[model samples]
Target: MSLAPRAVLVHRTTEYEELLARHGTAGQAAFFLTSRGRDLEPVAARHARARRTLAAVEAAVPLHWRRARVERADLDRFLFGPEDVVVVVGADGLVANTAKYLTGQPVVGVDPEPGRGLGVLVRHRPADTARLLTAAVRPDAAFDELTMVEAVADDTQRIRALNEIYLGAPGHQTARYRLATATRPDPAAPEESQASSGVLVGTGTGATGWLRSLWRERSGPPALPAPTDPRLLWFVREAWPSPTTNTTLVQGALTNGDHLRLVVESDRLVAFGDGVETDALELTWGQTIRVGLADLRLRLLV
Candidate 1:
């Protein structure tokens, strides 16, 4: 028989908690904030609200259902089961941060501070958890299959993100690579060698974030995709033109089966997702990587 579905509560360390940890005392934390021309009351209040909201969500879980709690820092090491019902109790970015580690688990995004957030992903309040949890396990439960992006290295190392995947140097230096795409209609077009900051591939959901800033600067066709659109958008950040390297293939759109291929020309290149640089795939010279739409979609409960 199948085991009962687990309610996995995901959260991040609050700023107040971090301050207290750093200062070793609440009074010292407040003093440090005061010295910086900021008040501690607001931070403490937000922390209190977060704790209350987390408690409420935990209390709402069905007593008999298996439950687990994980912090954002520990997500990389945490094991998520197939039958897990993930509940992210923080900002919308927290949901994005947690998305990559999960497979097809249904996620319920709960806004701890409702009015302050954009409410795009974290649409529900703490009180809605119990009802949402019940609906999430049903056969006809409604969910939005948010598209995600992935980068796969030739050695089988890979990473996925709900927002975007960044492949480039780990620092402020330029990254050198040969770029090509398999989806281009023009078969005669040749691949280009590039030396620049890096390459970024993002989904429609990501268009509102990093991709939006880049999209706004350029005026052209192939509009950004919708949140659920299967298409992806890619851009080469500050591609440097040289005698040998060209910037002809800077930006484009990708379809379902399309992928962007890159052969590393530098000593090292890193591929990371959702701005988490710590957990990334490292590539050496001559190693190839492909960026494309991932098979894993984020099953976000609406």
Candidate 2:
């Protein structure tokens, strides 16, 4: 488990070949899969090729089959269960499936086409498939009993190693939310105030994203706000703001301390991490939505 991942991009021959070259048939491995929304032909073909290649790899691990692997139980296997990595190739749907199935999780969303997948792509990161699932068995997400301040074991590495975290509309509303934060950080009393139209959580890992969005309203390269580590939170809002189910967590003394509420007296509001909607929770005014920094820190292959 102390090595690179068993790379699983989308369903592709080239992707498999590429990842295979990086980490050969090793300890434990798998092909965690999701529908490409395309004919299974391509995926089947890639599976054949991957299977054949995997057959030849001496260090390869047994490949297990988890039918309809995107649901909660199956996804639990995807996230915390021990095995090695299950590579996800090209398309983002499968990548998204993985994220949707987990919580307080950091998923590196990779978009092959920037124009088509700007929002989701920015969230994906290359991961160590082998390491993530090793004895994961739904490990304790809280880091209260850690031997060190930094995580020596699994500690929200999903988000921390990836460094950046994303917030987006929970549904297809295209709705945006207001942002607010304390001028000074007060964890004990985070919900004391609210301000601004756009809410962004900028971390030390995602500087450019929070800052650049401020410049062009909504324009930037695919790789801005990339975080080296998780620290700091940026709050942003859109100009000529349209309604969105999104809410930004204020960094300072206010919102972080307690229940952050999104008022939905008239219209409904959706909330989610990054852009996936399964966990995209609907909200009502005076209703409490949870938000906070998780203790688990990711250890990247880098």
Candidate 3:
């Protein structure tokens, strides 16, 4: 028989700890919060609850499987194998953060604070860890296969996103990139190009996120990606109409097997997945980035 897959618990630092780390002392942090009309009690309470939830989750793990805990900041250093299941012990954003590094592994999102909105990805409470983990490892497990987006650069540097992939400058300055896209579902369609501020390629799971805000601004937002839709939505931000640049190809959808390509006409451009800027791919002039639906899907346990 095969060994039980390891359950990797992922979490991040709480607001309380971040404040203390910045202020160097609890007393100093409290004083700083008071000056800003914020109290430390609420933050402390939330952090305490998170701790309890983590304890319960770890204790609930079965003995046959190896258990490991990792902080969100340390995810890049941690090694995950095919026989491992990832458990995110935070809000939906944490799930998005954890999904980029994953390759078709089952992910269980635990809402540490049940009172707050759990978001679609995190469907279970901390108390549900044991049962969820057990179901996740089974062959007959029922899961929502969430779509993911990918960006590959000329240098071969690649990244994936469960929510969205942002391509822009570090400081939000004017980003100059010549964009061309081939709508995969319609191969006979000719590719087009444009110069713009930046590009945003998102999945169906990201419809309600940053992409949603952009969608709301337009009289008609292209139908947002559905949770199981094997397609990606692409939008160019503030496409500048210049004598040298065409603004006609500002928005489109990239179906599965199709890709959107961008040539960095500017000196520099950066690509980050799911809002994690630290983990990014940097490109220079003449570099090409291809965006499309990723081969791996996030199997989120409901």
Candidate 4:
């Protein structure tokens, strides 16, 4: 007596033929998420996998892949218009890739990444690794309006950006600190607190990539909002103080109210973005620079 319609996905669904058949009937469109040419070349003689299944899938469903943006050719094909009933074989790239291309259609992340089952890391399963961490992400508004990419946004599906945000220093030199504030020309006077090295601020979508790691030390992991609540700023660095200082100011104060200030005693200070050199911000023993969330946001297709 149920009237809801269903669709089948055939990317890695070689074993779900019956299920596919059930969903493919009654004039409903089936959606399949496949590697296209992204799949590794098959062996010289073995075609026992979904190669034939994919061909049958072509006959089964009218593929509605992403094609929304030139930069997202790989992902754009997967996103369908809002009125479509969609099913997809989601993986790391597929899920993250789907964010920019989804057309507001109701979609099921089918054949998702083995570990998480579904959500975020959809179907990126490894042949060797069994356990993997999964997180949801959106986009940063600061860079969304950009027509061309001058600087690759923080969450550009690039692995390097995530690694820099989560991983700490190699040895134990300590993540040094300088003030990240709004005031120009920096601060003076040592009356406040000692600044720690690089702190990271995140929107909700970025919470899983960097905030979760820092939460292990300070706050616990919260839900993934489009951009998290109260806005997140992370202090990532390996420069733990030598215990010689009198007072250490962690996530200190700022005049902007929402911002934070860091005061380090040493002049060997630098401001790095993610993990690259941003600029050599010269500072005195006591100075204040404001740090707060930027007025930007991102939209993700889920």
Candidate 5:
């Protein structure tokens, strides 16, 4: 017999909870914020809303459907089953963060504090949970397939992100690497050695975040891709020009078959996706990685 559909509710620790944990009590937490000229009432209210949202979503799950709850910090260790229907409750970033761990499961993003967020990914509210959960379990349900980017190291370490990926030093120092692209029509072009802040490769869903700020700073020809576009954009941040390095190749787009290749020249470099640094791939000197569109897309329930 086939397994019953499962609902996996995902959430993160709230600011109020963090404050209480650090200060040891709600009164102390309020005092700490008050001393800093900040109000704790808003934080506490938001936390209450988040808790209520989670409870409503959980209650909406059918009793016959298996269910599980996962905190954002534990996503890296969570094992997602093939029949899982993911429900992420929080800001839009939480959806992006959860997208990296999933395969093709239909995801329903629920916003706890609605107007405060961008409302791009977390587009649903707590009241919509029961209906959305029913739709999500249907094999014929409609969903938007959002693009994702992936970086695969030659050693086989790979990472995927729904928003964008960052490759750079783990510290404040510059990242040293040799950059090249396979999409160039002229195959004989030489790779450039770069010494800069880092490299950023993002998807269309990412265009609303860090990629949008970069796009606004320049007059561009290749426009940013749509949320479901199969293309990706790469930018080399603060590419410095020196005797040994060049800044000519700073930005470009990667289509379906295109890839950006980076060979580590520094002693150590790190590659992280969706701003999750703890779950990242560390590369040493001479390691090579190729960044491109991931085969797996985020099936976001509309």
Candidate 6:
């Protein structure tokens, strides 16, 4: 007998669960929400709906196929094999976070909510679980390959990101770094040492996320990449001009063969991808880091 294909269901704690955890008691949670003029009914309803969705997914799964459930908090420690089919039952961010850890697994993004913004990634509803699962593990499953970004440090450490990678101080304080790029328009220009809030390197799939906010905040926003575009966009936040620091290399696009390098001029800097700080790369002064498009692509089941 052959082993059945495994399906991994990824989810996060519901709002009600979070409230109770924070308050330590149902009464306290209710009191806290009431104080904010919110009712617990909405949270309860959402939790109930999520449970129903999970149950439906469990029922839809074939007996021959192995099924596993993972919480968002444990995603970093979870081990995923290449043969597994990933199903995320959460918001859009959860899908992005899950994508980073996967190399070639087909991901089915399930939106717990029915008619909201129609999540860009989590487009499927809970009701479609059975049908999507059946198609996901098929040899000819229709999927879209989304681009991902990567950050490589001088210490030979590397992190891949499906959404965007953030490089800077742990807090909101200014980050001082020497920014250099292989694709700089002015080849003669020396590497620039600059002080800024931070830098964001993201792929086309991430354009609608953190990159979009940065684009919108600009005086003249540039066109961003589509979900499957094989390009990357990077920008420095609040680059400060000083006698020693320059801000000329604040924003640019990176193609397949291009790379962006940065030397940690500050005391400390950190690089995190998909907003998962637990899985972060730490950089001290005198360290150089490179950010670019990763060769691996996220195969998202559309």
Where is the poorest 10-residue window by lDDT in model 1?
181-190
**Each prediction's number of clashing residue pairs:** 0, 55, 1, 42, 0, 0
Q: What is the C-alpha lDDT of each candidate?
A: 0.92, 0.34, 0.86, 0.34, 0.92, 0.86
Candidate 5: worst-modelled 10 consecutive residues by lDDT: 181-190
**Which RMSD values do the candidates have, in order?**
1.4, 12.3, 1.8, 14.7, 1.4, 2.1
> In what order do the candidates fall by TM-score, top score first?
1, 5, 3, 6, 2, 4
Q: Write the per-residue lDDT of candidate 4 for residues 201-274, one digit (tens) a residue.
A: 44344455555566556534344334324344444433355554322333322122244445544543433223
Instruction: Give the candidate number with the greatest lDDT.
Output: 1
lDDT of 5 by residue, 161-264 (tens): 99999999997479999999648434665689999999999999999889888777756736999989999999888889999999988888999878999999
Give the lowest summed-lDDT range of ten residues in model 2.
Answer: 144-153
Q: How much is 139 displaced in model 5, in angstroms?
A: 2.6
Q: Which tens-of-lDDT digit does each residue in 1-302 have in candidate 6?
A: 66678999999999899988899987898899899999988888889999888888778777788889999889878999877899998888888888777878889998888676558888898778889989988789999998999999989999999889999998858999989864744556457898999999988888877898897887654579887887888889999899998878778888877888889988989999988888899999999999988989888887
After superposition, candidate 2 runs with Cα above 4 Å error: 1-59, 62-79, 82-198, 202-226, 239-267
Query: What digit string (tens of lDDT, one per residue) describes model 3 on residues 229-256?
Result: 9988888888777777777777788886
Pitting candidate 1 against candidate 4, the one with the higher TM-score is: 1
Q: Which runs in model 3 stand beyond 4 Å of their true positions?
A: 185-193
lDDT for each residue of candidate 1 in 148-222, tens digit (9 for 90 to 100): 998889999989999999999989479999999647535554698999999989999998999888888776836
Candidate 2 residue-wise lDDT, 100-177, digit = tens = 333332333332333544443233222323333332223442221100011111121222112223333433333333
